[model samples]
Target: MSKPFSQACENNKQPILDKLLVHFRQASRVLEIGSGTGQHAVFFAKNLPHLQWHCSDMPANHAGINQWLADYPSANLHAPVPFTIGQDSWPLELVVDKVDAVFSANTTHIMQRSEVPIMFDLIQKNLPEGGIFCQYGPFNVNGDYTSDSNRDFNQYLISQGCGGLWDIADLQVLVSGLDLLHQYALPANNKLLIWQKC
Candidate 1:
């Protein structure tokens, strides 16, 4: 099968890696939720060889993700484990023994609002204390859009029946056990929010 591709993933991988190099430097095992097409998994695993990158997503996405992994074939990057945030058990415990960091990109705003909190709850339950969680996406600050493009994107998401841009303050409430560490304004009007498990 051919590899599935995401242009957004290709554009954002490098900048995301620069930050991961710092926040996840001490991490040995990283769990990437919603691995999507697996482009980021391969790119990040190739660049950050020290950390074992485990990709997980719903079963439907696995084939495309695996195809991407097979082409790049990083020793540190593993295949996607079937994970349905609120339904499935944490894949880390089933696949690897543990994970010290968690990463997700462009997932939150597309997920149903109910699933967003569930994802965080699972991260809180499974992520070890002091573990870092990196969430990259467009988000509102204090319930206000940062740019017109993001406002439009939110409308598009809502039209698609997905949850729209979540306010940072609202996310903070959902992420109860994790402390917000850094919020980086990335290119394309997106933001990368880092949190540490308390």
Candidate 2:
């Protein structure tokens, strides 16, 4: 069976890539969490040849990611890594050197609130000092939805049993001691949370 494609992923890939190119121009290895459809991994690896791209997701998503990455010949793009939020450890056998950056898109709102902190902790463990962690998604600011569209989307997501939009203030509090830095907003209602390990 052919793998499914997400239109939103296609629509947002370029704009996201543009921002990434600016901030991650010097990064060498990027660990991408929740690499759904493998589209972003392939597109980014192709564009940022200097940086090694590591695509990771739950085991079920690996097949589709492998299919998308099969055609890419760059030595920089590593095979998909099986990763899950809250897991005590990763599947990779060797403790490879810490990554330079970690990136995730549209994943935070789908995971439970408690899982978010665990995810950040894992990112902190895997990233080296000064490593960058970038997350993109719709978020609430000061406990209020940024737009009616986001509010509606939050309801829809919660109705489906997934976690809804998160509050920026809440998230900032979670990362308070992690030495993270917030970057400017993205094109969509989504914001990019960028941080570096101090």
Candidate 3:
């Protein structure tokens, strides 16, 4: 059976890719968090041949990600890895030094606000000096929702027992002590927070 496609993923991949190409030109060993369905992993690894892509997500999503990899296996694309953002012990057995960059898409809005700091701390611990962490999702700014669509989406997320949209300021404050630089605004009202470890 053919793998299912997510319309949102399809619509946003190219735009995300364009931004990645600009920042990831020299990056190697990219760790992708919340690699749902593995479409972005497959596409990015194929396009950015120089970077070794490590796709990861909750254990349940790893099987589907692995299946997606079967169709487009490449030297730079590692097998799907199991990772939970707030877990004390990561499931991966390898003891790598540090990743050059980390990328996550459409995940923050679904995770609790309190968990955000923990996730950032984990990313900081795993990233080497000058490493970049890129997160893509909808965000509120200055305590106000950016769009009506985002407001509705936030409500729906809460209804589904997930965390709603986060404010840019709130996230910035959470990462304030970390060695990070922020980049905001992205296509489709979604924001891309790029942090370069100092």
Q: Pick the candidate with the highest lDDT.
A: 1
Q: Count clashing residue pairs in model 1.
A: 0
Clashing pairs in 2: none
lDDT of 3 by residue, 40-120 (tens): 988888889998998888888877888889987988998867788777444344345357888999888898777778888
Alpha-carbon local distance difference test for all models: 0.91, 0.81, 0.81
Over 1-198, each residue of candidate 1 has an lDDT whose tens digit, in order, gives 667889999899999999999999999999999999999999999999999999999999999999998889988888898998768878745345788899999899988888999999888888889999999999999879999999999999999999889999999987889999999999998999999999
> Tens-digit lDDT track for model 2 on 1-198?
587578878878888888789779879888898998888888888899889888888888988888888865567887788888876474453246557888899999998878888888887777777778878889999899988989999999999988889898888788643564765576668888787777
RMSD of each: 1.3, 1.7, 1.9
**Model 3 accuracy (lDDT, Cα):** 0.81
Give per-residue lDDT, candidate 2, residue 61. Answer: 91
How many residue pairs in model 3 have overlapping backbones?
Answer: 0
Against the true structure, candidate 1 reaches a TM-score of 0.96
**Runs in model 3 with CA error above 4 Å?**
88-94, 177-184
Model 2: lDDT of residue 147: 87
Looking at model 1, residue 82 earns an lDDT score of 92
